[model samples]
Target chain A: MNPGELVPAMSGRAWRVPPRSLVEVIDVEGSQTGDVFAVPTDDLEDGLSNGRTFDYGESIRLTTGSVLYSRRSRPLLTIVEDEVGTHDFLWAPCSQEMYEIGYGVTEPHPNCLDNLTASLGGFGVPAATVTIAFNVFMNVAVGQDGGLAILPPATAAGQSVTFRTERELLVAVTACAATTANGGAAKPLRVRITEGAGSPTQGRA
Target chain B: MNPGELVPAMSGRAWRVPPRSLVEVIDVEGSQTGDVFAVPTDDLEDGLSNGRTFDYGESIRLTTGSVLYSRRSRPLLTIVEDEVGTHDFLWAPCSQEMYEIGYGVTEPHPNCLDNLTASLGGFGVPAATVTIAFNVFMNVAVGQDGGLAILPPATAAGQSVTFRTERELLVAVTACAATTANGGAAKPLRVRITEGAGSPTQGRA
Candidate 1:
């Protein structure tokens, strides 16, 4: 796949990934977390449910071969390739409130919640219904005492994780705006898409 | 609290808890998990978000003084008394799909998802909008390798966890229907409500 399609810093984009196709999310500038969300093209209510995925998958770590499940207990996507195996499922998309409360930012801030909602808003998924994300290149660790922390991802520049869509999926990916989540800064990413081995490249920030 | 108000096994109930009032969820028959959900009384859109609670609280364990947060980053309830400190926020409410897929049960099984939705259906929150819950008296542990398991609760018969409602809220509790969640048996629960010392006790599974 080419260097992929650019998703600007602190912004998002949505596109349709053909069923049985390969879709890769690339960390163009490393350590920038991407909030990944997918809902079936036809229905937004049945969105990614981390509760179901972890319940069925039996492991919190989603690496290669991990099948992402939906709220209705259906497989939505399969992780076929992973360069950064340590992704995060423990966080909600960052919000303006998070900035104000956690970072003491008084002004309006661009955040993944708004980005994802707006990106999928054109596709009819309302802001309230937006599901919690699967964070690409975001590292999370739970301590022996059950303390959860967001650690900087070990993903390097140009590395990527690819997925196989179980069906035609409306996928949205955002370069997360939370500085605390992405080491100490936010950067861009890319997305590459192809139908099969011989298919032309169709696909980030 | 007079043994609380009964919530039958494999079912649920919903009621308005006055702001600042003390409400207790009693695992009447012991080892029963009550899937707890709360939404602002006037707004169904802002519901329980375990992710937010854990994100801000920094721990998976909920006990006395733990405040339950809403999806919008608002505090909805506060745990004032917890006899069983190991409540769970990890698992989604059990469903028929779990019965069929995990246990090979073919019949339409009574589950906490349906029970919660049905109990709160009268309040106008559509089944599709019901959020993942905070499980009362449920024990869940994560292993060193990030393996998640549902273990039997340590709450004995008649033990209860009390909460202080931060606002007028529509609180729902269901006796979890999954046998795996409740030490291999589905059992009833109760709710006890009290305004203050010397006040009338009002409270279930």
Candidate 2:
């Protein structure tokens, strides 16, 4: 993805947190690093099965006016606008455990869960209220012999995706799982939010 | 989410389990969920983040075909389809340590890490293989007290999210930490996977 410009959001609501919510991904460079998965707001029983994940190659590089769906086969949300490198739909996020296991506990790097928890807190969510999550960009492919294959991202910088929240939601996100050993050690990526880029309100701001 | 219709996967990657690597999530009623979050695939250091957080009224929900962006502001992936309810993007996945804290050493229930590890195992990835994640349909909001306020999910029946592997990737997901005693316990939900539902073409049977 590339750092082109900020895209606008689709439609927003006032339902508690507004029945629906949307997030715009700006890659800043043209690159696909991982995948993304999602579920519904009310139902929490189905942990991993709640989402409908996807890869970038499957569709048009996200841009202003793209619509994304969920796993249960419903119109989860819609992308209002986009800029920069395309976003990925198949990657997952990173976590503290991952750091401990991969980088070793001795490493002082913050984990995915930490960033998420902090982000949640920043969003008015409490520190202890963090819940489990679905990984996004990080790719861990399975081999024929039932093995994990950690691979590079398929997306670039400066891409984006937008959607409308179907209901009130509390969302959190992180950059790539790449680190010093990987290639993302330089700095974290940049993300932004806008209002109404799709539907009748495309590119409000 | 309601079990809309049964679309068996064209391949076993959706639900095949010689103990194939697959994750399941059941959507209870009355919540919203997100379907996708994209990030870097190899950089285990920077899991999904764009350096921004939301306020009390702001949120990101993942529905079918939805995309989750990074701090860099890019679309990592797109939500293809879903079956569960709406999803939360702010909530972090649970870990075994959480089990000890919540369950008091009674043996951790199926947590996010557990399910993810299982999913990785299907790909021959060891338990130590770590990657970033995008928590599908989790709810972690900012609170009035300037703290995290992870409210119960607003997901309903028959809602789900699906993703297509952009690049051959190995991803993992967990149901959620809000299950059973959290909120779904009042009405425990069940998640099911067919080809293309959660797992990949090489796994689901």
Candidate 3:
């Protein structure tokens, strides 16, 4: 991989991240939510499981130095550095059903699941591989009564979170399409996959 | 710390875990929730923060290999091994207000915050340091509509999760008192603080 290759993750589009690289998801404009999902190159059933990650780490909110694990309790990636400290781990990637059920949108809509599925199609990977995602810069707060409030991104422009892949895997990055829930019209996102100089397991920043 | 000292975490009781130790929370019986919280020995404001951990990890659900980071993004502990993989990081520690509001219990009830506060009182730590906790064996699910459901525990008897401390800190463990929410009467728990033979930073299973 190149040392500093930049990839444009347009609104409602997904990109496949190469392994052994640092994937940086940058919020080009404030209040844009980036949805990210991953699956091992060899198997789809062993994809990332948010439930398992929450159980093992014993937390719902994440920050730097945390490892994103697969369903089988294996390290898939590690968060080496982060500038936006708030993100959502509770909500699923938006789907057509979600738009219709939650927002009464009957027409076809661009969603994260579709973007990810199409992006992985080139690799001959099935859509089933698209499981739970790490909602970068998406703020979802849990109330005192255990209620969840999905709020817009509080991250400033140019803020980002970087992840180092721990194994050979296929990652999908999506700029979400929800306009109202995400605060405004979805904006373009910048994703950069760079080859770091040190060990991938080393925590940075 | 001894090699294998068994500390009884009696129902509704709390214990302060020592630093440089492996803290194990054991569900002596099935269907029990153990509330666990921690704070730095030198600073109360630098206590464990679930929001920060979630943001750093980039996932809400955790598993082994996940580092629980403090408010300042410093790692406080790491999940070395886990027998019961279902835990909760979304809900706050049960308090008197929660008991009154959720269950309509007006009288004083055995709560996690009170237990943790009293446990740290002898060390001159105030009750304000008691923050959110890792609810071991507690299962809370997030719905597609961004709603949270606090479910009954799915952990079986003797299932446990062990943590390796990364810094000198004080930890509090409480066997929950909500019999209904726990699926049955809350049972006693076992907490063992063992001195490891290797470096504290080593991740083990």
Candidate 4:
């Protein structure tokens, strides 16, 4: 309705979106990747399931028209618009332990898991439950033999992808803090919510 | 060891395997699927990582010569033998919430998450720490666009896959309870560990 929110670089933010509303994640500054997570308003315990979405939706590269599913297979959000098509759903959210083990970083490093857990703290969600996150603008290339290559985002400045909420949902977006998918650097992201912006769905339930 | 242990249909078992020891998972009956989990005996806090393995190993369909990495990127185990080459490392461990939400099954259902949690209870590891596990004899085919297809196990009766421990590790095996990957049924699995087995590594860090 008013000014869009900005997900500061290396941080995260969470809020609710009503049914039929449109939500957009903008790559505010080029090549800055982020992670998106959704949990139904009525069921904060249940969250997004990349496995279920891939199984039911038929692909991991979710673009326009792809329906994101809750762990229960309930439709939560549908991708309605796409300015960039390559998003990663395969990798798990990065955490503090990952930095310690992978890079021997002993200092406190901001990670998606902590950012998400803290962002969802208002809902009393714990860290472990924050297991999976749909990586927005994160490029993961799957090879013929199921090999995965974590490439940099193909997104550029001002590019954004939009989604329509199938039901009232609590969503969190993070400007991914890991150096893996953000071209070795982290940056800011933008989120805009347009109330009652999309038409109701047609056809079977 | 003398007799191999049997993970009853819908249950799990845990044990420690010494370095270079050969561990085998047998599909006791044709079409049975299983889940494999490992934690360093020293650190029960950390476990396996599908994301890290897929990144370092460069493939999800791990077979002979594939080294499984821990969450911190430490090499824990290597696949020295693979009777069934097609396996899934994509899906998260099935949980009770999954059955209730996805299938509306109200009855108490055995799941990989619970089975793993209970099995690792002996080591004082909690449920939340049992985050990721590798699905053995489980078929998850990835489409060209990263879509996933859960298919029946191609493993025949008595067919098995073997792994060599890179270090002393606490390994757990479970007879998968979910039907999505087992063709709508669950069955028993077999685990056998050979002590003081296999030759040392040739060249690896």
Candidate 5:
């Protein structure tokens, strides 16, 4: 099914992407972090693993042409078109506990974990299946001394990154919980899915 | 076709592996490094990339259940079994130029690149397809300060790591030019391929 929806700032949405479909994530308002997570529609255990993706990609910085791998080390999606060159490969999805610990906030705090789980729940994906996610449009840098710093996004409004799904997938995305965690107003992000040129039953059939 | 062969130290061998096959690499001699490389049988430009594997795996160290990804971020192979838990993911295959720069050695020094290219050439694969490889049985450690140190192999003779091919692959292996690169006698390594549980034509066909 094709979907074009706006993940309002501090919120998320989940979609079922068929094989060989293209999922485009757009930074609608710019400078807003969009956390993207995916799992195979049939196997939650074989979902996207940021650690494995990083280990396989051999870099924490992703660009156009980078492949996002699943926990099983199979290609789940490929970044075919990238409008924003910088995206974060480090850092886990910010959870409510992290918000409480880092920002002294209580429940009802907007967090990625909660948003992702809520969105994915509609697809029968369990909460525990949500692990590390890609922080699109987020600019986190590593220093010469291995120190990591979170900086404002370098992407401008309307910039986007398009990923071609290599497998049938359940994808969830959040506009980020900066309203509580980073103390900034959350901005909206857009997602568009289209049919890819590759055959739907090309691989893993 | 399933084949078993020995790659002598200071030498290399290449094989064409059908999809859904397993390649078992045995460290026949203890403390010897075995360099392993692979490319899609049809495309040399899509050879294995260690950087992408590490980035996707999100770890520098690999064990059973880890995937070996190609430069295009697709799964070429998966580690199905590991007899020796330790494997080197930090350093690229040693080359003749590396020998000259690091050890003051001149030409004729056995190196992984030459061996891999020579082996792959037998199958019509060009020299340019010899990309980064996994230095199996080699021990490299990351220090607290992010420094990398190549140490002697922690694996004993007869230990092995088995990888299952996810796609049609052309695999090359070298017994490592240890004589000049590591100042040690190079020993023989064994490569054995067998059919995997997954159907041979499950993906590409």
Candidate 6:
């Protein structure tokens, strides 16, 4: 990596590490978005520090105005608005390398990395600033057996999520690990974005 | 948008497109990743003249040997392996202005388009070859009153989708959208990418 270059922000609530100035993700066709996802820009490590445990409510049990706390015992993000039904908190990001290795070098369609860079450049954010992101649409769960399982049926379609800004930050969002394993390989989804109306929604934006 | 540059093959199934191409995008987590997805190569388009839909059993969908028919009704690509649950027929690509305007610049984060350019350059893909895309993960269902309504329960986590290449191609992926409306604004998720086995789990790879 270059000295001036930065990795992209994580996809889920971890994005709160350096939370975007404003954030929004839409759920086209009966998919649910996250209710409370947040991070602290001041301490990205705190967002996803090793051995940290943040109590997450069941994706199916989430309600409006859900407050999400970080493992660091701080306010992360919140869920101010939700349409559709609920959002998933377990999906992963998509990437080109993964696509190539997972599928083959010849696999055609673009992956998440391709899309995020373009958006970053368009916003005048230097490509060098790209960092790992925190995705809000995915559903990664910890099973009772200590296994990391991405729970399905976590979200409904037409569900939207809004993240208000606590500060001016560059945020990134991607659809997710829409693979045959995750049950999103059939149809693409629709995501929309809207600004926050003063109050920060789930520490998102 | 320039013609002098060499672009990646664009296809529905992905594998049918040219190899080693590039794609660009703006937003992610905020809106649907498919809201602005694309397929830009001509040769890649010519390959998928026939329609091939991957319909896996209820537990999983997506045919590895089948091909995709792009919006232009052209052959997009082929499925190499689908470790994820399913691939979508309706996702959109990510964008920037969409985020700034739709999500409100107040707390705006990096969209897909921005991410695309950066990723392309990072991967050594010329910027000229990259182009914008249409939505891939989204669907706008028709309502009884002829109005459009968002479908619920769109995607699940741990779903991995992989495409195989019949030709060289470029690709991009983002998880964030700029739209905060519809309740998509909450927290960000985590997106990661890794290489997969060259062999396709379905058969094509």
lDDT of 3 by residue, A118-149 (tens): 87666666654454578889888765434456
Candidate 6, residues A121-166, lDDT tens digits: the string is 4545433222223345545443332223445545565455655444
Off by over 4 Å in 5: A1-3, A179-183, A197-205, B1-205
Q: How good is the docking of model 2, by CAPRI class?
A: incorrect
lDDT of 1 at B82: 81
Q: Per-residue alpha-carbon lDDT of model 6 for B1-205, expressed as tens digits?
A: 2222111111111111244222222122322333222244443222111111211111112344544433233334455544332233312223444344334465546555555545544545443222223233333342222123344323343333444432344444444443331135422222222223233333442
DockQ of 2: 0.03
TM-score of each model, paired residue for residue: 0.93, 0.36, 0.52, 0.78, 0.51, 0.34
Interface RMSD of 1: 1.4
lDDT of 2 by residue, A111-156 (tens): 5445655545444543322322333333334332212344554445
Off by over 4 Å in 1: A1-3, A196-205, B1-3, B195-205
Number of the predicted model whose lDDT against the real structure is largest = 1
Q: Judged by lDDT against the true structure, how good is candidate 4?
A: 0.80
Rank by TM-score, highest first: 1, 4, 3, 5, 2, 6
lDDT of 1: 0.82
Name the weakest run of 10 consecutive residues (lDDT summed) in model 3 chain B: B2-11
lDDT score for candidate 2 against the true structure: 0.38
- Please give the TM-score that candidate 3 achieves against the real structure: 0.52
What TM-score does prediction 4 earn? 0.78
- The two-chain DockQ for each candidate, comma-separated, is 0.59, 0.03, 0.02, 0.38, 0.03, 0.02
Q: Model 1: per-residue lDDT, tens digit, A1-205?
A: 3556899999999887778778789998898899888889877777888777887877777888888888777778888888888887777788887788778999999998899989998898866666488889888888877788888878899899988888878889999888887878889989887765312222110
Model 6, residue A81: distance off in Å is: 3.0
Candidate lDDT (C-alpha), each? 0.82, 0.38, 0.69, 0.80, 0.73, 0.35
User: Once model 3 is optimally superposed onto the true structure by TM-score, how far is the C-alpha of residue B101 displaced, in angstroms?
Assistant: 38
Name the 10 consecutive residues with the lowest summed lDDT in model 5 chain A: A196-205
RMSD of each: 4.2, 18.0, 18.9, 4.2, 14.9, 19.5
